[model samples]
Target: MEIKNNRLTGATFVEANAYNKTAVMKPDAIIIHYTAGASGNATVKLFAAKTSKTSAHFVVSEDGTITQMVDLNRKAYHAGTSSYNGRSSYNNFSIGIEISNPGYLQKIDGKYYTWWEVKKDKKTATPEDKVYVGKHRNAVTTMTYWYKYTDEQIKAVKELCQAICKAYDIKEILGHEEIAPGRKCDPGPAFPLDALRADIVSNTKKDLNVSELFKDAVKESASTSLTIGRVKVKLNFRQSPSSNAPLKSSPMAADTYVYIIGSDSTGEWYNILYEMTGWMDKEFVEQDNTDDNYDGELTTNSAMLYNDQKKSRRLVSDLKAGTKFNILDQQENMFRIQAVVEGWASSKYITKI
Candidate 1:
């Protein structure tokens, strides 16, 4: 994962001819994105086309193959009219890396589908490979089936960002969604965007490695029973499970039901998430009540079970017409039911026993 001559990204450049001949760019940041297209080669070719009007410096595939399209020393027309830190039009000050991903997937029928209306198997689409299911900040769509960044892709991006930082004196790393906010949402939460910058750009480690990633998943996930926590008081939410890991911008306020990622090595810290990953002292965090009283039965066999309120949350396992479940919670038009399978469904599609 070395950059040579600001052109060859680890001995590969996909001949990116569709770029502006601007004066040399003294890059200060890296903006990450997802192609939302089919594959790496297709995305590379699309950016190479002069009419595409969008291009990235590099495109990393799902399997971690790096294809340098635009030279790192030049500005790639990736982020349009994006601003950050007083710099408007982010393309001028950043190198863009578009990873090949489907972004958020829409599950349909007994199968899962990409935004392009391409169908894939449920098992293949949302495998527990370096991915986590969660909600996003300031976005209507909860990540029912998040497109995960592969382990190989994660490592490659880490090395590539480190190289770019050193090559161009890059000072910051950001996502397309961050720079453009309401207008864009690439490289979403599931991709570990923060963890990438923490590990490579800022030299910190919010390590979501194999051993610790799923260590407490069964015990902490919605599968076992959602473990909701409340902060006793204000607590420092550091990046990694360490007291010294660099506090995230936000804090765990008193009595907030935080989303739990996992626990620390010492079990003294509860790796939690409000918007992003951070650690708070476990002692101050208390497991709040998770009991609910309603019991119900499905009135119809065709009723759809979803991961969330969004009916796009199609679950593979279906409950028979007379199946029973315990209602954990209820929102405006959806009911969170469990026992048979933990998920949400339209209240109209189910009935209480």
Candidate 2:
């Protein structure tokens, strides 16, 4: 599957009545939800109603059929009064996918029945295999019965997510339950949310290497002083310069390297390029003051590792060719290397990695 012009190529497109038509939305996250209804067509029809007042981008049926209700570029009213990683109102920057499932089911007389099914007086019991018994992440002690997602539906959602990530710089795959924990629980415990996220996001990062991304960003951006920074702690990579901005993804691990391209007006947030382009707090990043910061490899057969950068340097050792070391500091025509023997090496004999 492929996405073109913010729409999936082989999916059925149906316009929804509820969405932000005027507001510009650059989605970087996907929020998964359950229809809580009968089928994908039912949810599509509901979204098409003039009085629906709520909408999602896509809906997946049990048989793996997908119906797109809203353009991927538009804001669909999926996540209501939501927040994640200190950012609020997820609809502004996330695409929503509604999987067709009955959601949490009610067990009566050892038979599982959807709340909607019971309301219609039909009272048809769901199959045992199709029902999953588990506790919602938001629940304290209540064990709930949730409708299990079909294998076909799961495969469809995975492919759809992968396609979305390939089309856009999608940084996160979240459940509606995660974004609005107390208020909502959808694509619930029955769904393999974490596994799907790990599979899709891991592949996305592999498809787009970080250093290659940095080079592309640097080429397109205006002139700025580029520097190196190491994350001092696990830090949030935000879409904007504020703490309230949506997170690019999970927190970057401590000691992750990033390119500091620029800063916000307050100078408290540093615009960075690493696994992805985002903003990080300046306080949590250790900026490399030197102009050059990189790993170096010795080119000569016998390169001298010196203790000091002086006319008459103290010899530390003779390093063999292709010896790799991190550049710790730099002086005129000399670089301090963190090797077996921490010392200086001539710049001419070292090549940047």
Candidate 3:
């Protein structure tokens, strides 16, 4: 598909022999999993093989590179016998992303099954080189296994979640264990579920109102302006909502600073600092600070001009002082004005009084 936005990417059609051709799919949920293989390449190869009887829509490597395996429109075999929110057969209607990791733990067998011991020989069983085995086992099964995912793997998964939430009208995200609680547990305790969910929910919620959320997120993520004379001064360090919180007070100047993030409808305050998000106070900032020198001479360099048509060249001799002009906008060297008087005195002669 054309990848209309940041939604899911098109599948690369790997190891798809087991996919149900008759299954109709419309993704409403996201299923996360871990490929308990030794390496990402090996995991990809395994899923790509036609005989594996299992496939995910995408496989994210430890380094955050994503490999697509199945088309978003078609069914992938990853979610076997899974259900969520009263819906069954999730494979027919969900995107599955298998993260590459060794899983919860690793297993190593010392002295490769001494042949003499296996044969019950009285002589001491000669030891052989230790053989490593994958320890991750099915929770429901009797076998014991261990595999550990790397930090990079977890970060990659979170980013992938953000991307997926951005693209689809996804209502909920799930771990494989959540979908098949009795059978699966690939994404173990190491996977930060709360943090991932927070990102997904935050991104998905923001996409519903790109402009508003962007503005709000921007305001919330950064400090707001305070009028000091005609200039809008920014706080040296953004403030937060609480008095005791490290972010609540500015370490720079102790002036009255407003937190931009906290002005949401909920009445909470937050401020953006270095692009990082934090809570702050709404009372400290004003949206339309009237004292912003609206009474000053409507000049071309007042910092409010926003268009190109008004900044055209004009001679300095054509502007008149008492002729009066409303400051529509002000920019670098030009001022956009709506003429209040018809007579022209001089062009470039216009100066802010």
Candidate 4:
């Protein structure tokens, strides 16, 4: 589990069929993904095929075996149309790791099956204990089922990520869903992404520049006022809070949720955040002011809420055990909840009622 000359030693190397042969990238991040296939060998074979357009640096099998499909320094076409932290096109800046998984599953006739397996009436049903049910951050509220990752695979991933972070000074570890939400949901809720990220970053913080990067990120993200608003009608998202302000892009559709940051002097214009930050007319944006809708409660004796999700240490309020809260939103392990206060808390400490 050691990185040597832009490759992992002691891991099987399988040349990928497609990758950027010219451009070499100094990666600062790692993106985790699920194969959505049966095994790591299948994905390895797919990447090795001449017709396959997708490739990744590494793939961890169900039994914890590691296989390297592409060189670490080369750009693998794993992230498509992705963006995160003001950076777009992640393939050029990050290493991609594909884990063997069937991804989300559907239950029918008391048997759990993958999406394709259900259509074929496949008799090989996943064990009940291997299915994880949870709400996706992008989804509104309803829970979804996904295949669980084995402890062995998780252990291998953690070790591999740690080695990469140490060798390349990697700063951020992200899921594919975070970089390309709505379009992808691999390495779903069943993966312990947050814990893994925290563990890796915490151990590498002293040597790497991740601490400073995280601080800057937290500062930038904290600029948002944490006000949720709904678009009342289709209108242009302007660069400024005036009618003469230039539009950022196409008109935002009605019912789109935005984070209201500030407003103009007249209070008729609101600065908001959707896919991008811009100003929208206050009259056309409805602010959320709903009553308490507690569907979860605190399990810990004490838990602190933060104004935003980026800064883990920033405190808003401390709640005692049995404190009821409503899950307004989620980002990784952090839940934007409305409990005694409207702020973010670790989902690890909250259980659904």
Candidate 1 lDDT, 1-353, residue by residue in tens: 55678775444776676676767886777898888777888998887776777788889998898888877778888997665433467888789999998776655554445655644334454444533455543233334555777788888888888766555556557788666653456787677865665456234233322222222332244243334677889888887877788888667678766656578889899977564557888988887633223367667754655667764555523445554556778999988875323567778877775
Q: Write candidate 4's Cα lDDT for 5-113 as tens digits.
A: 9999989999999999999899988999999899989999999998999999999999999999888889999998776544568999899999999987765666778
* Residue 300 lDDT in candidate 2: 79
Query: Candidate 1 versus the native: TM-score?
Result: 0.54
Question: Candidate 4 regions off by >4 Å?
Answer: 205-211, 215-353
Between 1 and 2, whose TM-score is larger? 2
User: Could you say which candidate leads in TM-score?
Assistant: 4
| Candidate 2 lDDT tens digits, 171-288 | 5678887666534668878998867865764564667321345234334333653567888999999999999999999999997777787889999999888746799999999875
Against the unseen true structure, what C-alpha lDDT does each candidate score?
0.66, 0.78, 0.50, 0.78
Cα lDDT over the full model 3? 0.50
Residue 55 local lDDT, model 4: 95
List of clashing residue pairs for candidate 4: none
Model 3: per-residue Cα lDDT over 1-353, one tens digit each: 22443234543435445565665666666788878665677778887776778888778777666777666666888877665433567777788888886553322232222222324543442222222233222222123323445567677677666665555555556777656543466565556664676555556456531223323433432354322211124433334455455643344333433223224456644343322455444444344322222222423321221214343532211222232343555555455553311112223535553
Output the lDDT of residue 331, model 1. Answer: 93
Evaluate model 2: give its lDDT: 0.78
